[model samples]
Target: MAYSDIQKTEFNRVTENLIEITWTYVNLLEEFPRLDEQDSMSWKQMFVAWANEFEELYGHTNWIESEKTYPEAVEEFAKEKILQWAGIRKYICVGKHIEGITLNPYEWLLEKGQDVKLFESEAEAKIYLKTNGYTDEDMEFLKFEEVWH
Candidate 1:
């Protein structure tokens, strides 16, 4: 359905309602594949991509959550799901920011024999890895990129 055919009021109202319902359903489900952890990355990526597509089609922004507290069910579900998605091993998210906010906690990384570092920019992070002679395979799990840049 093209927006051109719909009345402005009707279009705006329906877009708002649909966005709310979509997010509610995603939050409620929390984890995809219903207890199957092996398929998490593919599932989450597909789900997020679908939501992103919907937002584009409707000409609305699906706001990224700042943070949220989850009930026991959702929390447990995410914990297990993430473990499986990341191969039940150590991984790190390197963000280039002066504030030094990490995607994963220090305790979690240390427990898995992993090291996490935050640089002022992606270039710095890559240079550090190269300087340390960390081959691409060795640094395969460390991702550095400007998501929107």
Candidate 2:
């Protein structure tokens, strides 16, 4: 893509202003040096000082962030979260759409006039039934089915 002279000038001005910062240093080489005048450094000097704390910070923060935009990645992540919150989806994936037909097994059982006692574990059911005064013989003739989510 070609940019007009005005656009290039405006873009350069913006980018230049974005990082146009100065750092004051008495002596960069020494810890604390007393001098009549302090030396100034560019924003890059401060950036490198901060980057020295981590090995990957410089490349990731400087190169990747300045080069790429993250709205696409954010949109993809947000799509899955929205689908999960809605508890249904028309499509199964982020790309190359595969139709998703959502069905609730508990709802299906209710529609069929089947009793569904949902307990994550046997211990949970035992605790519930025992608290509800269900006797050992009352548990007889009861069936259990393993349903996958």
Which digits, one per residue and each the tens of the lDDT, describe model 2 over residues 35-124? Answer: 213233433443344323222322244435554433333233333332333243332111111232233221211213554445665556
Question: Candidate 1 — which residues are off by over 4 angstroms?
Answer: 1-116, 119-124, 141-149
- Alpha carbon deviation, residue 13, candidate 2 (Å): 68
Candidate 2, after superposition: displacement of residue 23 in Å?
Answer: 66
Q: Candidate 2, after superposition: displacement of residue 1 in Å?
A: 42
C-alpha displacement of 88 in model 1, angstroms?
Answer: 27
Q: Which clashing pairs does model 1 show?
A: none
Root mean square deviation (Cα) for candidate 2? 22.0
TM-scores of all models?
Answer: 0.25, 0.23
lDDT winner among the candidates?
1
- Local distance difference test values of all predictions, in order: 0.44, 0.35
Candidate 1 TM-score, C-alpha based: 0.25
